[model samples]
Target: MKRVVFNQKGGVGKTSITCNLAAISAARGLRTLVVDLDVQGNTTHYLVGEIDADAFPAEAQGAAGLFKQTVGSRKMHQNPDSFVWETPWENLFLLPSSPVLTQLERELESRYKIYKLRDALQKLDAEYDRVYIDTPPNFNFYSKSALIAADTVLVPFDCDSFARQSLYSLMDNIAELQEDHNPDLAVEGIVINQFNSQARLPGELVAELEAEGYPVCATYLSASVKMRESHHEHRPLVDLAPSHKLTQQFLALYDELESGRA
Candidate 1:
C-alpha cells in the first residue's frame, strides 16, 4: 500500500507519523520505502540522521533530481532506484529530499509534469510492500504530487479549534484533487495526534468531530515527551522504546490501518 501522511498545517507531526509507521512496517519484515518530498527534509533527517555534506549527492541525484530529469525528456534514463538511499534500519529505504526542490516547483508545473510522480511510483509498486510519502504543509507541487501518487492519505489532526477549521479546507482540497487527478485516492482517516487525555478540552474537541461525522481513527496518540526524545536520537518510537506506552499506541494504530479499520 502507498500512503501519504499530510496536513496543510505545520507542527502537526507529519514526519513523525511517516517515519514511525514506516519503521514498524520494516520491523515486521516488510520492504518499506519513505519518499520525503518536503523541502524541510524532516523525514529524511528522522530516518537517516544528519547528512554528510561531503558524501551527499548533488542537486541532480535526489528527489529533486528525479523531477528535474523528467523535464523535457522523451524517456526516463535514470532508474528510480538510483535515487533511493539505504537507511540504517533493515528493509527501510529513503528517497531523500533536497533544497533544490524549492526551486523546481514552478518549472515542473509549467512543464506539465504533474503526473510524472504517479508514473514513477507505479513503477516502484512491484518492488516495495509499502511506500510512505511525507509532504510539506501546503497544497503545493510536492504535496499535490504525493496526493496523486498515493493510494491513500492519512491526515494528522492536532486537537484544536483552528486545526478543526483547517481540516475542512484540507478535505475540500483533497476532494478536488481526487476528482481531477487521482480518482482512486482514498482518505484512510484522520489521526488524532498529541492527544491529551488528561485535558477535558481534547476529549470534547474529538467528540465534536465525531459528532460531525468525521472519519477519525480509533487510536489516539497521547502527547508524550518520549516522542521528542525519539526525534533527538533519530530513532523511531518502536526502535527507541518498544515497550513505552506511546510506542504501543503507534503499534495499535499501525494494526488498525493494516486491518482496514481506519
Candidate 2:
C-alpha cells in the first residue's frame, strides 16, 4: 500500500508519524519505501542523518531527480528504484528529499506533470511491499502528486484549536482532490498526535470530532520528550526505544492501520 501522511498545518508531527510507522513496517519484515516530498527534508534527516550535498548532486538526489526526469521527457524511462536509497535498518528504503524541490515545483506544475509520481510508483509496485509518503505542510505540487499517487492518506492532527479549524479545510481539499484526481485515495484515519490526556480541551476537541463522524483513530500519540531525542539521534522509535510508552503507542497505531488494511 502507498500511504501518504499529510497535514496542511505545520508542527503536526507529519514527519514523526511517517518515519516511525515506516520503521515499524520495516521491522515487521515488509519491504518498505519512504518517499519524502517535503522540501524541509525532516523525514530524510530523521531516516538518514544530515546529507552532505558535496557527495550527492541535487539534480540526482531522491524525489528531485525523479521529478526532474519528467520535465522534458514524455515518459519516464529511467528505473524508479535508482532514486531509492537504503536506510540503516533492514527492509527500509528512502527516496530522500532535497531543497531543490522548491525550485522544481513551479516548472513541474506548469508542465502538467502532476501524474508523474503516480506513474513512477506504478512501475515500482512489485519492488516494494509498502510505501509511505511524507508531504510538505501545504497542498502544493508535491503534496498533490503524493495524493494522486497514494492509495490512502493519514492526516496528522495535533490537538489544538487552530489545527482543529484547519482540519475542516484540509478535508475539503482532500475531498476535492478525490473528485478531481484519484478517486481511490482514501483518508485512512486522522492520527491524533502529541495528545495531552490531562488537558480537558484536547479531550473535548477529540470528542467533538468523533461525534461529527470524522475518522479519528483509536490510538493517540502522547506528548513526549523521547521523540525529540529520537530525532536528534536520527533513530526511529522502533529502533531507538522500543520499550518506551511512546514507542508502544506507535506500535499500537501501526497495528491499528495494518488491521484496518487486513
Candidate 3:
C-alpha cells in the first residue's frame, strides 16, 4: 500500500505520523519505503539524521533528483530503487529530501511533471511492501504529486478550531484532486494527533468533526513530552520506548490503520 500523510497546516504531526507509522510497518517486517517530499526535510532528518554534505547524492540522487530528471527526459534513466537510502531501522528505506526541491518546484509545475512522481512510484511498488510519503504543508507541486501518487491519504489533524477550518479547505482540495487527477485515491481518515483528553475543547471539536461526517480515526494520539524527545533523538516511539504509554498508543494507532485496510 502507498500512503501519504499530508496536511496543509503545519505542526499537525505530519512527519511524526509518517515516520512513526512507517517505522511500525518496518518493525512488523514489511519492506517499507519512505518518500520525503517536504522541502524542510524534517522527515528525512528524523529518519536518517544529518546528511553528509560531501557524500550527498548528486543532482539526480534523491527525491529532488528524481523530479529534476523528469524535466525533459522521455524515459526514467535511474531506477527508483537506486535513489533509496537505507534507514537505521531494519526493513525501512528512504528517498531523502533535498533543499533543491524548492528550486525545482516552479520549473516542475511549468513543465507539467506532476504525473512523473506517480509513474516513478509505480515502478517502486513492486520492490516495496509498503510506501509512505511525507508532503509539505501546502497544496504545492510536491504535495499534489504525492496526493496523485498515493493509493490512500492519511491526514494528520491537530484538534483545534484553526486546524478544523484548515481541514475543510484541505478536504475540498483533496476532493478536487481526486476528481481531476487520481480517481482511485482514497482519503483513509483524519488522524487525530496531539489530542488532549483533559481539554474539553479537543473533545468538543472532534465530536463536531464527527458530527459533520468526517472519518476520524478511533485511536487518538495523546499529547506527550516523549514525542519531543523522540524527535530530538531521531528515533520513533516504537523503537525508542516500546513500553511507554505513548509507544503503546502509536502501536494501537498502527493497528487501527491496518484494520482499516482490511
Best-matching candidate per TM-score: 2
Where is the poorest 10-residue window by lDDT in model 1?
Answer: 53-62
- Which lDDT tens digits does candidate 3 get at residues 9-51? 9999999999999999999999999999998999988988888
Worst 10 residues of 2 by lDDT: 69-78
Best by lDDT: 2
Write one digit per residue (lDDT tens) for candidate 2, span 43-134.
99999999999999988889999999888756566798999999999999999999999999999999999999999999999999999999
TM-score of model 1 (CA atoms): 0.97
List runs of model 1 lying over 4 Å from the truth. Answer: 73-76
lDDT digits (tens) for residues 1-262 of candidate 1: 8999999999898999999999999999999999999999998888888987568765765798788889865656787878899999999999999888988899999988898888888888888899999999989999999999999999999998889889999999999999999999999989999999888988998999899988899999888999989988999978999999989999999999999999
TM-score of each: 0.97, 0.98, 0.97
lDDT of each: 0.91, 0.94, 0.90
Give the Cα error of residue 152 in candidate 1, in Å.
0.5
TM-score pick, better of 1 and 2 = 2
